[model samples]
Target: MKIQKFGAGVFTIENFLSKKECDAYIHDSESRGYEVATINAISGPEINKEIRNNDRVIFDDTELANALFQRAKGFLPASLHGW
Candidate 1:
């Protein structure tokens, strides 16, 4: 994993997921279906098209999440300076 840091806490990891991995994720999400995306406001989570107009799938797949996190862990800092 190659990480590139830009100014102002911006960063990017090239090829974090290969084409095959990305395709699998897309397929899985599509199979589950997507709902209108929502945004978190002071009022709480709600669909706000102006803010974010897209579809998303919210699911609980801890195994997948942990796998991805582990793959990227080596490129991540233990903690941020101010956060």
Candidate 2:
């Protein structure tokens, strides 16, 4: 017989990245030949400082960053945030 828990390991595990690489990719996309504007890095109400000055949102996780971008689509039409 065998006993197990669903999502057992995943629930307790977390993934993170080193700071160096995290910021590196962000700085790289500043001038990628597109109409770039305000960019910010934030968590779900976990944003610490204002990042309006930034033009590339770099996060420790790629998927998480993408999710944020997708959710921001509602406000993207304005080309600015902080309403």
Candidate 3:
């Protein structure tokens, strides 16, 4: 059986970003009146877990991935993560 990662979908983004840029973006997001939480790297889709939706987002999947999920339905907010 293929050992697939289970929990919530994950995201990969630029990590080594300048503090100014990071802080500015995060601050701007908050100032714009948006809830945000910055965590260490893209771990897993985190927000609500009781939904029982464990999905993986392979952004670069050559097979086109489960197709570009616009809604990422049943998991959690896609852009809720920060730097």
Model 3 lDDT per residue over 18-41, tens place: 678679756755565633333233
TM-score of each: 0.81, 0.22, 0.27
lDDT of 2 by residue, 1-83 (tens): 12232552222112233467558655655544333244334533333335433233333678967875675444343532444
Indicate whether candidate 2 or candidate 3 has the larger TM-score. 3
Worst 10 residues of 3 by lDDT: 64-73
Instruction: Extract clashing residue pairs from model 3.
Output: none
- The deviation in Å at residue 32 for candidate 3 is 1.3
lDDT of each: 0.91, 0.43, 0.44
Best by lDDT: 1
Q: lDDT per residue, candidate 1, 1-83, as tens digits? A: 68889977789999999999989999999999999999998999999888899998999989989999999898887888956
Residue-level lDDT for 29 in candidate 2: 53
Error of 2 at 77 (Å): 2.8
Ranking of models by lDDT? 1, 3, 2
